[model samples]
Target: MGRVTTEPSAYHRRMAEQKRSAIIDAATGLFLDSGYDGTSLARIAEAAGVSRATLFKQFPTKAALFDAIVTEYWKVEGEGGLDLRPGDLRAGLTAVGRRYVALLTRPRMVALFRIVIAEAPRFPELGQTQFKRGKMPYFTSVRRYLEAEHEAGTVRLDDPELATTQFLGMIADYVFWPRMLLVDWSPDEASMARAVDEAVLTIEARYATSSARPA
Candidate 1:
């Protein structure tokens, strides 16, 4: 039998990915605890058990690391996995609203929001990048779902984009904002259900066709 040898490049690539994951995990905790202005690459490297040179090789800057952390959070949090189903528009929208509220109101996500808000003035690009990468994709997906519903006669909206925005805003104002602004304020299941129900009802009343509405 011929001798087999593993490729050095493949081994290096796997190690790099493992290191990146570790770095992101450490950075997420540090960023959540200390906020963006308070976290440094040295601290993250030490916490991640990597050298500063290795951390720099992966992220290059604090903002870049923050961006990676936000992206990783969303990926693990299932923000990219929301999909509009074929039946029961109201149920689908309600589920989406509830999940979105849950994600935004979670402690870690609220901490991320605080970090972004606090550091946005100093690192404006961080805010922009978070919106472009983290927030906009979900919003765009919702808008597209609404548009499909409208075209399918499931909803009757003059503007699907505006209607989608309004639907999200309803939940955000009712559930997310309070939790974000008040550390002591956490919505119980009843409150979350009520908010999501109201948001679904409002959207259905305004946009869903009579046949598409829940009985």
Candidate 2:
């Protein structure tokens, strides 16, 4: 093979990414410190050390900036795709489930959820966009994992979407609404483990074939 060379465009792309990340970091800090209504575009631009025009160019509207922040919150679990291999479907799913709970149960993400829910009535599109981009993808991935496990004779599932929903519900029942929205509770490791274990057992019980059932 001939000698490889990096393109000049790559340097510009890296600089652009760094600038965008700085803007996002500034916006997130401002949003968290001051409620959405209190934060202004000029304040964000000042915090980012960029001009208003540059900030506007990167994020045309306040809603767009908020949407980007919300998207990042949803991805706090990192990008490890769920693996449903031949061995133990329930165990594999539990590993993913624990990680998912870890994301939802984080205090920062909890605050982010509260912010989204609080502003949702004024910015309905933001809520809808987040649901489409975040929740739907997560639900679909989990459902597909269950479906594949069913096909591989590792587990059994009737209506994989419903099964996935039920599994998530088991975990979210305690963590999502009550702790994040209604109450002022902070989640700990032991509590998170208990929740994930119960969720795993519930999902496995619903999907395990007769032969695959635990004793």
Per model, how many backbone clashes are there? Answer: 0, 0
Over 1-215, each residue of candidate 1 has an lDDT whose tens digit, in order, gives: 99787766887989988999899878878877887778899999999999999999889998788788677655524544776664578877977887777667654777677777877898898789789877787788788878778778898878878998898999888777776667788768898889888988988888888889767
The candidate scoring highest on TM-score is 1
Candidate 1, 79: how far from true, in Å? Answer: 11
On a 0 to 100 scale, what is the lDDT of residue 177 in model 2?
Answer: 67
Model 2 local distance difference test score: 0.75
lDDT of 1 at 21: 88
Q: Give candidate 1 regions above 4 Å deviation.
A: 1-22, 32-38, 76-80
In model 2, pairs of residues that clash are: none
- Report the C-alpha lDDT of model 2 over 1-215, residue by residue, as the tens digit: 99787775877888877777778778777776786777898899999888899889879988888777766666635455665464576677787788678667654666666666776787687678768766777777778778877887867666888888888888888767677545656667788789889888877777787666666
Residue 99 lDDT (model 1): 73
Error (Å) of candidate 1 at residue 193 is 2.1
Off by over 4 Å in 2: 1-19, 32-38, 76-80, 181-184
Cα lDDT of candidate 1 equals 0.80
